[model samples]
Target chain A: MNNRLKILRAERDWSQATLAVHLDVSRQAVNAIETGKHDPSLPLAFRIARLFDLSIEEIFHDQN
Target chain B: MTKIDATHNLSESAPSSVLRKVLITIIGGLTAVFSIAFLAGYTVAVTEQGGLNAYAIGTIAAGLGLIGLTVFISYKLWPKGTHEAVPAREKKSQHILWAAVVIGVLLGGYMAVASGDNPDGVFSNEPVTASFAVISIATWLIIVPIITWMWWRTIDEHEADAYREGALVSAHVYIFLAPTWWMAARAGWAPQQDPMIVLVIVSIVWSIVWLYRKYA
Candidate 1:
């Protein structure tokens, strides 16, 4: 549930909308994920990691 | 309401002069209210007259005219939305939704018009009435639901979540609202219950809440 998605997006100098476009999700979805209001499904998580050119662990951390 | 962009410290003010905006909004609101009143009165008055007359025609025209005026005033006061291009897929899906809506209205309108005065169900033996009845039933029961389901499946997860949240809200509202209406009707303070109309009302609320969650 805890992910550094916001930081990763910022590191790439991307707006949420920009990141959302790449991820094929809404800006609201990206915001919700970053804000920890929702967690991405496994496939989406893989897609996000692939987009960032990192492994899943690099992008997401288990808060549990 | 102010929108705060998290990515940037963006500040946007009203595009029009504040005083002019306020004046236009007030005038537009009054016009819209009057148009609604006229339409309501026309419906009742025209029904009592048992046919279309000068009074009915004039009332309909006046109501429509005021509505047009309000739309014009609203356009002048505040333009609709941003010029951001909706994705082509989204646009296509929106078109589908619009098409379904238009079809539903046409079918429903035909049924209402063909029913004569009181539609005695499919056994009425009236050709136009029976045909429109079948079409309207199919429109609502089959066509509309298919279009809605298609629209729901095509949206992103966030938009779907908005829909889910909307459904939850509507469900909660109906839990209280249906009982209150039933209580009131039982006590003779309200008219008899119509399940179909209540369901329609709930559906409207669901859509409204979904839109608010998506765009708010």
Candidate 2:
């Protein structure tokens, strides 16, 4: 899944570490998601969406 | 946005996914081997050894301790699914794992040799002795510093973490092996003449397999 995570994080002026802390995950996880190296689990996707106060669909779009 | 673009993106992301999949496969394989050996040793020792109660208790305690440690590390170090990739952190994590493996082998070898002779002969009734107990305790002490060093070196102020979780998993495996090692040593499986030649062989094979899987 390609996400605007980097852009969103930048807009919020938050580092990956800050976002990771907020999500209760490791910074590497955030990095993985941002670089499209790893896709987030459903729970984590929900958490990320909730953290940014956006719908999951808005944050993560299915390519297929 | 387009199918072509999506495919391109996926292709671009393939390498890390491949790496993660390979890692998972290797870990799963190791877990299987360790589990089989542990169970076999436990069964053999319980049936063959005299102190069934002590063996059972020791195995359970060691297993639980290892499981707890694995869980703690995983929760602390593993990425939660969103962090950006940091190559440096990944390298550090690999280094920590290598260090742990080296330390574990060294300590195991030391304990195997150090406790070869029954020094005090206190537990003569039992298979093991005061010397074996001392060695086991000493091995635990050595393991602590090695584990701590791995944690300290792998974790960073900014990198997205997933190593602690991985370490925790590794710890659980180690824990499961600890009792078997102790019991085997006590059983004189590692005699002065042969001295756990099988374990040494297995350890060498394990290392080779791990390296092949990881790098080859």
Q: What is the lDDT of residue B138 in candidate 2?
A: 70
If chain B of candidate 2 is superposed on the true chain B, what is its TM-score? 0.32
Instruction: Give one digit per residue, the lDDT tens place, for model 1 in B83-135.
Output: 33344444555577667656744554444345434433222334564666587
DockQ of each model vs. true complex = 0.22, 0.04
What tens digits encode model 2's per-residue C-alpha lDDT throughout B1-216? 854454334434444543554455445434433433454455455656665586687774675566456446544543345334444655566567666656655554443334333322221233655776776677668776767666666554222223333344445555566666668778989533232444444445554443332222
Please estimate how well model 2 matches the true structure, expressed as its whole-model Cα lDDT: 0.55
* Candidate 1 structure quality by residue, lDDT tens digits, A1-64: 7998877877776666567667776655676788776788889899999998999999898887
Q: Which CAPRI quality tier does the interface of model 2 achieve?
A: incorrect
DockQ of 1: 0.22
TM-score on alpha carbons, each prediction: 0.64, 0.34
